[model samples]
Target: MRSQARQYAQSAQHRRAPPVRYSVAAAAVPIVAMVAAVYPVPMAVVVLAVVAVARYGRAAE
Candidate 1:
């Protein structure tokens, strides 16, 4: 029973982590832009946007 509970917890964590990670990634966009303000970071923003969009698209499927 303990093993089964642990398995369930692990499965739940696996299911939950992707969306959280994606959300955190998405939320960092503005921070990226702000950092871009002080340094050469537009490319970083662009790269992050591309990654975010791609991940969102994939998740939508």
Candidate 2:
């Protein structure tokens, strides 16, 4: 009975694990794009491409 209680506590700990939250970098994408846009279309395109790649890579992982 004591062993079973210990096993139940371990499983409960796993179940209570926190959800993954987005980092500041992940949250800054739109801000980066807006600032990058003031430079030029080519630069904006590059910035957007980089952001997209980063976001997709993160989601894939």
Candidate 3:
């Protein structure tokens, strides 16, 4: 059986994680793939958008 402290650590670790957001977004990858397949988006445009969002998120943090 897990100890109380280990349980507390697990709970805290779950709450503190940032990758949960990434996991949810990752789940939408197939949707993005389908959309991209229907309408071919430029690679440069996608890279620029991702970079812009990353910069914005970092700045907000």
Candidate 4:
């Protein structure tokens, strides 16, 4: 019973980290887009492509 309880607690602790990571990532994306917009045309496009690839990679996981 004690081992089961410990395992549950460990799983719950692991569950908590993702929301903090996701929220920070969510916030940063817009700021990055805004900054990207300030760049000359090709660099802005490159930034957008990078963001897209990053999003795709995360989605795959």
**Local error of candidate 2 at residue 58 (angstroms):** 0.1
Task: Point out the higher-scoring one by TM-score: 2 or 4.
Answer: 4
lDDT of 2 by residue, 1-61 (tens): 7699568656865887322333335446666678776765577576777777677657755
- What local lDDT score does residue 46 receive in model 3, on the 0 to 100 scale? 64
Query: In lDDT terms, how accurate is model 1?
Result: 0.67
* Candidate 3 per-residue lDDT over residues 1-61, each given as its tens digit: 3498467656866887535444345445566657766888986776675566556555544
Off by over 4 Å in 3: 1-34
> Please, what are the lDDT tens digits per residue for candidate 1 over residues 1-61?
7699568757977877445545555557677767777787568667877687767856854
Looking at model 2, which ten-residue stretch has the lowest summed lDDT? 17-26
| lDDT per residue as tens, model 4, 1-61 | 7699568656966876444444456556766677767865577676776677568657644
Model 4 segments beyond 4 Å from truth? Answer: 1-18, 41-61
Clashes by residue pair, model 3: none
After superposition, the stretches of candidate 1 with alpha carbons farther than 4 Å from their true spots are 1-18, 42-45, 48-61
**Candidates 1 and 4, the one with greater TM-score:** 1
lDDT of each: 0.67, 0.61, 0.59, 0.63
Query: Quick one: ranking by lDDT, best first?
Result: 1, 4, 2, 3
